[model samples]
Each structure stands twice: as C-alpha cells, then as structure tokens.
Target: MKLTSKGRYAVMALVDLARFDNINPVSLRDISLRQGISLDYLEQIFSKLKKNEIVKSIRGTQGGYVLNKNPNDIKLTNIFNAVDEKVKTVQCRKESKKGCNGKATKCITHNLWDELETHINTFFENKSLKDLLNNNKETRV
Candidate 1:
C-alpha cells in the first residue's frame, strides 16, 4: 500500500519537531522551511495532529507546536490515523461486506491482499517515531 502525502508529511513534520524538541514549541513555519513542506499544508496537517493530541499548541510571540507525547511513545500508526490516511491495499468498497467484485461472494485474491494489509498495519503499529530517528541515524552513519 502506498502512503499518502498527508501521512508522510505529518510523520516528517513530527520528526522535525522531535528532533528540535529541546527548544520546545517549534513553529510550523520553521518545520516547513526545514523540511521543504508547505507552511499551509503543515498547518492543516498539524490541526488534525492537535485534535488527536499528538501535538500541543502554545500561544504567544514564541508560541508554536510541541509533541504531546515523547517521540518513543508516538507510533507511526498514530500519525497515520491522525491524518485519516487509509492503508488501503485493495479496491474493495469497505462499506460493504462483499469483496471488490461487488458480489456477495468474496474475490479469489481477496484473502491475499487482506492478509498483506493486516501485516502492513501491524508493522506501522509496532513502529514509533524514535524508530524512524534511529533508522535515519544509522543510514547517515
């Protein structure tokens, strides 16, 4: 399954926050410039993050946003769900119990994709922002 820009950008933005968390309440504009993300887009993404309590906002001249939880406690799945990013591996209409074939019966290949999707979700559920940071450091080394 492909991760949408909202999901990817949110994760990147949060990582940027975690990276500079020592400063506390890093502004979206700063994250946007550093990560090459659009400030407007980051604002929209952060709105949802705030709603989910993944990030907290502070007001004032030095106000911005900060992580609500520690980086190690913030799972990748949390980021994905906060932005409503669906990890869809199939073309099936999820509202219906029937498979992508639009019939009452399940498609022949439905189980394969379904299992793969489960594994994909589990992978994200197990991964945290700290994991991403550690991986990045390894690659840089």
Candidate 2:
C-alpha cells in the first residue's frame, strides 16, 4: 500500500498550496524547490490534476496552480486516483495467479495478507487530505 512517487509528490504539492494564504498561484519552480520535486515531474502531475478538477491554474504574472476546492474539501483518495495509484500490496493481492499457489494451505498467510490489504485500502479510501489537516491542527492546539 505504498504511495507511488507521483502520489507522494502530489500530496506535497497540495500541502504547499495549503501553506499559502492567498489563492494566488504558486509557481511550479517554487513548489519543486520547497517540496524537493522536479519541475518537469510536477508539471506532468499537474496536468492530470488539472484535468480531474482537483486544481485550477491562474495565468499572467501571478500565474501558478491553486486548489479548485478548499483544502478540507479535497480527499487523499481524490489525489491518489488522479495519479492512478493502486492499493495492492502485491500482484496477488488483486487475484493475480502469477505467483500464488492454488490451495490455501500452500499460501499459509494468504488470508491475513488479504485482510490487511483490505483494511488498508478501506482506510485510505475513507480518509481525505482534509482529515490530515484537521488532525494536524488538533495536535498543535
């Protein structure tokens, strides 16, 4: 259930957006520098996010990207889906027969792995990026 680099960077990009007080766009170059992501890579990710309505861009001297919705309105799953981040812990986690033995006895811990994966996927699916921000605030004060 590890997040792909795309997903990780996407979240970081959003967090950078969250930090800014103004709806004014933040340059990709600045986000890349602050978040330690590549400009080219951020551009590519932003294309997908923009298409999905997760973000909107403003042009001109103030040009850059901003969230289409408020921070609390965005979900982690929304960001994850924007990048095609799958929740499988292994190929077999999705019923792939590539490496699995047919019998349950052969894969002694198959059920456990499957259950764990289900729980993880469910958690991420239900949780939102907004929840993350709320929790952070709660802990601080």
Say which candidate scores most in lDDT.
1
Query: Measured by C-alpha RMSD in angstroms, how accurate is candidate 1?
Result: 1.8
Predicted candidate 2 versus true structure: per-residue lDDT over 1-141, tens digit per residue: 355799889987887876673746788888999988999999999999999899888878868988888777787878888888767654454455445554443266667777887887787777766777667678865
TM-score of the candidate numbered 1? 0.90
For each candidate, the alpha-carbon lDDT, in order, equals 0.89, 0.78
Q: Could you tell me the lDDT of residue 127 within candidate 2?
A: 71
Candidate 2 RMSD computed on C-alpha atoms after optimal superposition onto the true structure: 3.4
Screening candidate 1 with a backbone cut-off below 3 angstroms (N, C-alpha, C), the clashing residue pairs are: none
Residues 2-32, candidate 1: write the lDDT tens digits: 6689999999998889888777779988999
Clash totals for all candidate models: 0, 1
Q: Against the hidden true structure, what lDDT does model 1 obtain? A: 0.89
